[model samples]
Target: MLNYIWSAIVLLSVVCSIFLGKGENLSAAIVDSGAQTVQLLLTLAGVITLWSGIMKIAEESGLTAIFAKIFSPLLRPLFPNLDKESDAFGSITMNITANLLGLGNTATPLGLKAMHELNELNGSSDTASDEMIVFVVMNTASLQLLPTMLGSLRQTYGSNAPFEILVPVWLSSACALSVALMIAVGLNKRKRRL
Candidate 1:
């Protein structure tokens, strides 16, 4: 469905360009679009590599483990079904840590793994458990200490201070995350009442 929509949009744009006697401009636009995509991918790759390497070092130095331990209490209520020392907890912590650092590309695999583990604990069912829904909400609204992706985009666009958005990002993310968690908890309670 999305593919068809994109195809229609491109076709319409080309027709409009032809009618405007600017058909030649379409080729330039397409080339520029492709170039921009390639540049974005390269930038993403570089950022992911740098963060992933730092994460690996942190793991080797036991920093990741320390963080997992520190956050275990908070994570317990969110993932009550999982054992406190489970690998899922570790993966979830690492994933959240990566997200807070704004290394989303690096966090994706770990998040998937955490979800997979959570599903396994649920006997691999098609339906989502309460914990799974809560996890989704938490991940979606995870607080960010560093808005690396946004900073990268700002830098790419030649912003004078790419990292200047830090304080606002931190405050907004914290509020959003708090609200998301509260909503999830309320829904869970309402489900129990039903």
Candidate 2:
């Protein structure tokens, strides 16, 4: 579907350029944009790689374990079915820690593992469990401490201070998490009542 959409968009753009007598400009734009995209990706890859190594070091140093310990209490209520020291809990902790540091690329695999573990806890049900929904919400609205991806984008784009949005990002993510938690709890309770 996305492929079709992008193809349609490119076809439209080519048609428009031809009718507008700007085919040459469009040709130049395509090459230039493609090069720029590659350059930006390379820079972003460097930033992501650096952060991934840092996260690995943190994991080796038991830093993620510390985060798991801290988050365990909060997770208990949200995921009552899960054992306190379950593998799911460990994955969740590692995933959230990576997210907090803003290494989204690093967090993806952890999150997938966490979800798989969570589904096992759900007994492989067809429908998503409330805990699964809550976990998804938490991951999606993940509060970032570092905003590494955004900072990297800003840096690549030549921003003077890439990480200046740290405070705002934190506040927004906190608010999102709070609201999502409230909604998830409310909906779960409502489902129970019905």
Candidate 3:
């Protein structure tokens, strides 16, 4: 469905360009778009590689473990279903830590592993459990102390103050996460009562 929508959009743009006698401009834009995409992919690859290497080093040196311990109190309530010493909890902690550092590309695999472990603990079923729903909600609204991706983009665009948006980002993310968690919890309770 999304593919079809994109195709339609491209077709409409071409038709509009032809009618406006701007076909050459459209062609130039298309070429520029492809070039920009390639550049973005290369940039993302470099960033992901650097962050993943750092994460691996941290894990091997027990830095991740120490951070996990530090953040355990906050994570405990969010994942009450998982045992404290379980691999699921560890993965979730690492994923959260990566997100907090704004290393989203590095966090993706950890998040998937955590979800897989969570599913296994839910009796290896195909269906998502209540805890899974809550986890998804929380992950979606996970807070970030650094906006790494945004900062990188800003730097690429020659921004004078890439980190200037930090405070607003923190405030917005906190409010959004709180509201999302509250709504998810409320709905879960309602479901249980019914």
Estimated TM-score for each candidate: 0.90, 0.90, 0.93
lDDT of 2 by residue, 1-194 (tens): 99999999999999999999999999999999999999988988888788778777877887877877899888888988787678788888888888888888888878888899889988988988888898888898888998988888998789999999988999998999899888998898899799
RMSD of each: 1.8, 1.9, 1.4
lDDT of 3: 0.85
Give lDDT: candidate 1, residue 167.
Answer: 94
For candidate 2, which ten residues in a row score worst on lDDT? 50-59
User: What's the TM for model 2?
Assistant: 0.90
Alpha-carbon local distance difference test for all models: 0.87, 0.87, 0.85
- lDDT string, candidate 1, 1-194, tens digits: 99999999989999999999998898899899999999988988898888888887886887867888899889888877777677777778888999898877788877898899889888899988887888888889989999898899899879999999999999999999999999998998799799
Q: Is 1 or 3 the stronger prediction by lDDT? A: 1
Candidate 1, residue 181: how far the Cα is off, in Å: 1.6
> What TM-score should be assigned to candidate 3?
0.93
What TM-score would candidate 1 get against the native?
Answer: 0.90
Task: State residue 77's C-alpha deviation in candidate 1, in Å.
Answer: 2.4
TM-score-wise, the better of 2 and 3 is: 3
Per-residue CA lDDT of model 3 for 63-173, tens digit only, reads 777877888898777666668777777777888888888777888988898899999999999888777888788778878899898788787778999999999988987
